[model samples]
Each structure stands twice: as structure tokens, then as C-alpha cells.
Target: MTSNIGSPAETTQPVGISPYLSKRIFTLQFTSTPRGARLARRLVAVRLDEWGVPYGTEAHETTVLVAAELAANAVRHGHVPGRDFHLSLRVTAELARIEVSDTRAERVPPRPGRLPEPELAEGGRGLLLVERLAERWGWCPRLGAPGKTVWAECALT
Candidate 1:
């Protein structure tokens, strides 16, 4: 099967690709639409369940919140006509990382800022929630393309 760029080369790369690298990375791409965002959140819950994170448990709760916010931003702020967003959950020995990438290269996600009043705002609270939940969170411009990926990580218990 043909593969996209930056995907590991089928033939070979080199030695010393982390001996303890993770094997349970789950990734999927969905259309850049509101429905897609909703699906992303549902999928995260399902996957976390598969990995034994019980519903309403701390890991499950934290991961779901992070996934939901990132996917919503991908749909709301980073969507481009005819493009899709990618959602990835990578769990290593020490952390769980959730990433959402979408095709709106010109727009960059702002750094998390102060929270607004709960009754006075209809928006601008997503990043605040992310900052409070994640151990660390940030974004990176997709190389060789016109999109950005927002990612968050939390410790593994």
C-alpha cells in the first residue's frame, strides 16, 4: 500500500530507533467537519476503554477532555474545505499524548491564557481547560504542509 510522507520507510532507516518505543499508538483521520469532531471524541472514549481505562476514571476523564478540545479546535478553527483532520493517541511507558492536526496553516493556536468569567463567555475556555488538565500541551506546524497539530500529554499512572 502506498503511504504518505514522513511515515516510516518500509525498506530501512537506521539502527537505534528507541529500544523501548511504544507499540500502542492509535491514529485515525476524519473529515474536517463538526460531525468528525464528535466522532473523534467518541472514538477516544472507546479506545481508552479498550486499553482498560474505566469510564469516569482519572485517566479516562483527562484523556477524553483533551481529545475533545483538540478535535473541536481542529473542526472550528483549523478546518479547510475538502481536507481532513488526524487524531492520534500515543501511550508510552510514562505518558499519554493526544494530538489533533488540521489543515489551516495560516492559523496558529494561541497559547493558553487566563480564563474568562463562566457566565460572561461563550468561548475562549477550551485552552484553559487543556492547560489545567494536561501535564504539558503545545502545537507544531505540520512540516511540508499547511496545517498545525495541537498536542497534549498527561502522566501515566
Candidate 2:
């Protein structure tokens, strides 16, 4: 519930938050750089471990990869000088949601299953990975803000 996503040290939950609900959500903002993307992936993995999902498990592995791809795309295609990208992970009894938001709202990724035919020689396969790993994925313009958010969901049950 707290909007403190600017750095790793600022992960305090809001006042009076319930412990059960607090563990279900995690959010952070990072510089729109490769290091930031890497941090996004690492942090999410650590959080999953704390939540009992643990690394190396199917749920943890898929969610981490999905977070990495989204974060990398945010840095590579959605970077805007001085603007940072945001990451949010939410888990429930039956599902997990990963969301990455960046300042470049105009640079949304290709829709699911709409990647260019035959693939490219040098790159352009990140979303394809998300499509294969996530139960579903999509993007939307940041509500009441500048930029967009790309989100992927996975079933835990």
C-alpha cells in the first residue's frame, strides 16, 4: 500500500498494514539501466524465497524469468532519462502477477503471439519468452500517469 518504490532500502510497509496482506505484495522502482533490470530480477527472486516459493522451484523459476524479460525490455525500449522503471509482484493462493512500468508509454511491446514472423537474426524474442512462460501477458497505459505497464500472470495452483 505504500508507494515507496524508489530504492531497495525503502521497502517499508504502510502503517497498520496486516502482516498476511503485506507479504502478498512487493514493489520497487529502479533506474532505467541494465543494472536496474538485473536488480529487479534479483529482488523478485529473493522475495519469492521469503514467501516460501523458494528458488529452483517451477513457480519461482518462471516468475523470475518473466520479471527479467519485462525489466530488460523496460530498460532497453522504455528508458527515459531521469525516469525510473517500477516493478510489482503480487502472489495469491492461486496465482502470481508481475508488472513492470516505464516512462516510455509509446513503446509498448508487440501483442501476444504477434511477434514478427521467423524471428529476427540479432534479437526481439523477449516477449515470446513471456508468452511461453506466463499464463497470460499484456500492457496498458499507466492510468492517470505518463508511461505504460506490462504485466504477466502465472497460475500457482
Please count the clashing residue pairs in each candidate, in the order shown.
Answer: 0, 0
Relative to the unseen true structure, what is the Cα RMSD of model 1? 5.1
TM per model?
0.78, 0.83
lDDT of 1 at 53: 67
Compose the digit string of candidate 2's lDDT tens values, residues 1-157: 1245445423444468654455377888888999999988998999888767778889899989999999999999999999998899987656779999888977777777777664562577788888889999999998777999999998765
Model 2 global lDDT (CA atoms, 0 to 1): 0.83
Q: Which residue pairs overlap in candidate 1's backbone?
A: none
Lowest summed lDDT over 10 consecutive residues: which window, candidate 2?
A: 1-10
Q: What lDDT does each candidate get?
A: 0.77, 0.83
* Candidate 2 Cα outliers beyond 4 Å, as residue runs: 1-23, 118-122
Q: How far is 51's C-alpha from truth in model 2 (Å)? A: 0.6
